[model samples]
Target: MKLYSLMTTAVLIASTSAYYVKNQKSETFSLNVTPVDAGTQEECKTCITFAGQTINDLLQFVLQEEVDVCGDLCQIVVDKTGKEALGVICTILCDVVGIKEFINAIQKADLDPIYFCELVPACPINDNGDAHFTSLEVMPKKGPQGEFDISFEYVSNNGTGTGMLAISVDTVDGIPLGDDFLNFAQPAGTYDGTIKLDAKENPDCDPTQGPCETWEPGTYTIHLSVCNGECGSNHPHSAIYDTKTTTFEITQN
Candidate 1:
């Protein structure tokens, strides 16, 4: 695991993360996609796709408070689908991949069940490749201000274990900050790094014009996005493969 560390102060940034929120398909979103003739790489395309989408739906249906509970949720879906076979395969793959200490890491990590099926014998890996963050660790959970550090690990399909990284921090209430981290260039492999940062009052806010911004004491979310090459702000030209967000609260010292 390659590790890099940096220290910096918080700057206000327009939260462009709204674009990443997935819009769930309508109430009647159908899971009926016909299997295409893709040779041997996708023999289980239909089953895998159906299972994967079902998993996604089950996950989304969970109440926000219980979103992280997957074991019971997943078991319910498998039972409902009448496809105990796939559940068995999932258990086998979960064990064989050793992705997490426990087999349910598949559900815990929210790994795309379809893409994960790529590990199955008949459903070969996608030729397009993949990139994602495996873990995010932070300290002083109260907030990301002075004397705070965040470490995260990521894996990508790029030949070299490097790629571009962009980070943004914002309050859940939609307060504005400065233009924070843009893009740190790296490669397309597995890498680990930490960044030390301090939260700041809105640097752009002027007291003469209005109240100088204060770092509110509440929940704030930090977003990290990685791209195969260049990352775009809007829909087109967006090659971002993975995005992860961690939330922390700010309190009076």
Candidate 2:
């Protein structure tokens, strides 16, 4: 486990019935939360007991009428306390139900943490090597529609673990694109696969429409992110090991 640090500043703000506005005056604070390995109920309880008061204060501040409930409360807490109290709150919350549960709770509350804590297996020690994207090749690179093949490699220098690859596209236009995710069982060596890049392939685009009608001619930015261990789990606990970006052109044909 790695210690997480959160930095924030306090600011005065004016409020109206409709909205809250920020003021110019402010103060800054830094917080560092120590990591704890908790697998049992007693361990979780003990961790929470130590930081109960700070968590209570955070909840109170977040529930205030003038506060932005959807925003990050951890930063606000850090600003208010100007100490490591915010980190303690986060550490306790994460230890209570693991990183996945903690993240789900934060998302459900529409709150953001300063930095997400990665999850490691409860029973086994994780010693997997980091995964990375080695190469990317697009077929018919100038066409309106084609396929992209990406290669990934990892070394089991530490130990054996699972890996995952997540890919997404961003167009010059604001139109939404689709994303693809794949999982790898092997912890070492190389893996490769292809993903279709046709506009009709996009679920958001109507299949009846022709490719030209559905896609705009321009450039698309592709993003690749790879993670090791707990790769297949929803709200995975593994950290992103590598990220790569590349561009493909869609020309009028």
Highest-scoring model, TM-score = 2
| lDDT against the true structure, each candidate | 0.44, 0.40
lDDT of 1: 0.44
Q: Write the per-residue lDDT of candidate 2 for residues 27-133, one digit (tens) a residue.
A: 21111112232343222223223232244455455346343322254455566667554455555555656545544454432221111222211122234555555
* lDDT score of residue 125 within candidate 2: 21
Q: What does candidate 1's lDDT look like per residue over 111-191, in tens digits?
A: 443333433333433225456889766677885344446666777564311123556667644754322232222234566
Error of 2 at 68 (Å): 39
Residue pairs in clash, model 2: 119-237
State the displacement of the C-alpha of residue 73, model 2, in Å, after optimal TM-score superposition. Answer: 34
Q: Where does candidate 1 stray beyond 4 Å? A: 1-129, 143-145, 160-163, 178-188, 202-213, 233-238
**Model 2: per-residue Cα lDDT at residue 190:** 50
TM-score of candidate 1 on Cα atoms, chains taken together: 0.40
Candidate 2 CA-lDDT value = 0.40
- Model 2: lowest-lDDT 10 consecutive positions: 16-25
